[model samples]
Target: MSLVYSTETGRITPEKEQAQRPKGDGIVRIQRETKGRKGKGVCIVTGLDLDDKALKLVAAALKKVCGCGGAVKNGTIEIQGDNRDKIKDYLVKQGHTVKFSGG
Candidate 1:
């Protein structure tokens, strides 16, 4: 009998790369409020690693999972609406260590 095992070569496919990226530590607070000219309560995801592309990907994934509109700016993901629990749960399921911040 022969056994086959895959080693950690850090080689991941595009789909897998998107699915398996490690989310940084800390509780990302989701803030829904109309700030400045944007007259809409936007869900904001903060406390992410300071990486441009990573932030964008995280925001996109969260938006897809929550079925809402969002964008990444100033190192925060501004999702539309208050889906804090949903986003946190989704991130955790996606192999990310998540924490909840704010009330």
Candidate 2:
């Protein structure tokens, strides 16, 4: 169900403003996982501080660098195969603090 706004208050109101989430810290985590795809692998990057458009741009760039496909799902970047080092270096160049997690 959609929210119902009173005619007197209109669409622009303070209630919507309070729902936006604050940007994340500069830290990003790169992890490699392979348990869910019948031996196929993926690198999961989380803790991005940008909005949707920015995140999509970042994902595209990483895909180019890694020479593989990837997607930004639920604010996290999931790249095909293992790319922890490449992603870390790229993020570092972009001025973000990155950390490697998982095997």
Candidate 3:
């Protein structure tokens, strides 16, 4: 497996095969929720390969594009708000096959 990093972003993809897999390929669905203190809400992007460095790159790109604070944990990218379209567009432009889930 080869590790690839996006030139536009500093995010890294550890394995090429895993990154090209169909199981969880693409921009994920995001849901908004106001939980925890001060009712701070967040958007959740799931079905990603957490251990893969490529996914980390994807997460970082999404975060930068949305200009929001987020993280990659539990194999999911959690942004601060709904940014499905932005993430999808960015992924497509980066030349990775993307599959969008949820409404």
Candidate 4:
């Protein structure tokens, strides 16, 4: 049971809480994916336990360091091209435990 409407306020609606991201194991993984983009490789970074804003910031930094364009999707950062080595260096410099996953 909840109050849908109130006389004092027109159409009282409940606040929508932000969904929480699942905690990670403190290890960031960088993997290369090329299945969907017609052989265009995209570096998929995962295992970063960060909120949306922080995740975007990290993605931006990675893109800048790699000198390419990228986007943050589903709590994972996708950097254009195979920039694993560059990303690994940057993440390591940021003090994050980075691992290269898959072939």
Task: Tell me the spans in candidate 3 whose CA falls farther than 4 Å from its real position.
Answer: 1-27, 92-103
RMSD, each candidate, Å?
A: 12.8, 4.3, 13.5, 3.2
Error of 4 at 21 (Å): 3.2
Considering summed lDDT, which 10 consecutive residues are worst modelled in model 2? 12-21
lDDT string, candidate 1, 33-88, tens digits: 66773676676777676588878888888899989998887778888877888988
Candidate 2 vs candidate 4, lDDT winner: 4
Tens-place lDDT digits, model 4, residues 1-103: 9999989998988999877677889999999999979999999999999888999999999999999999998899999999999999999999999999999
Arrange candidates by TM-score, highest first: which order? 4, 2, 1, 3
Residue lDDT tens for model 2, 3-100: 46778877744444543544667689899989978999999998887888999999999999999999888778999998788999999999898898
Q: Model 3 reaches what TM-score against the true structure?
A: 0.53
- Each prediction's TM-score versus the true structure: 0.61, 0.76, 0.53, 0.80
Per-candidate Cα lDDT values, in order, are 0.71, 0.87, 0.67, 0.95
Residue pairs clashing in model 3 are 12-53, 13-53, 13-54, 14-54, 26-98, 26-99
Q: What is the lDDT ranking, best to worst? A: 4, 2, 1, 3
Highest lDDT model number: 4
Error of model 4, residue 81, in angstroms = 0.1
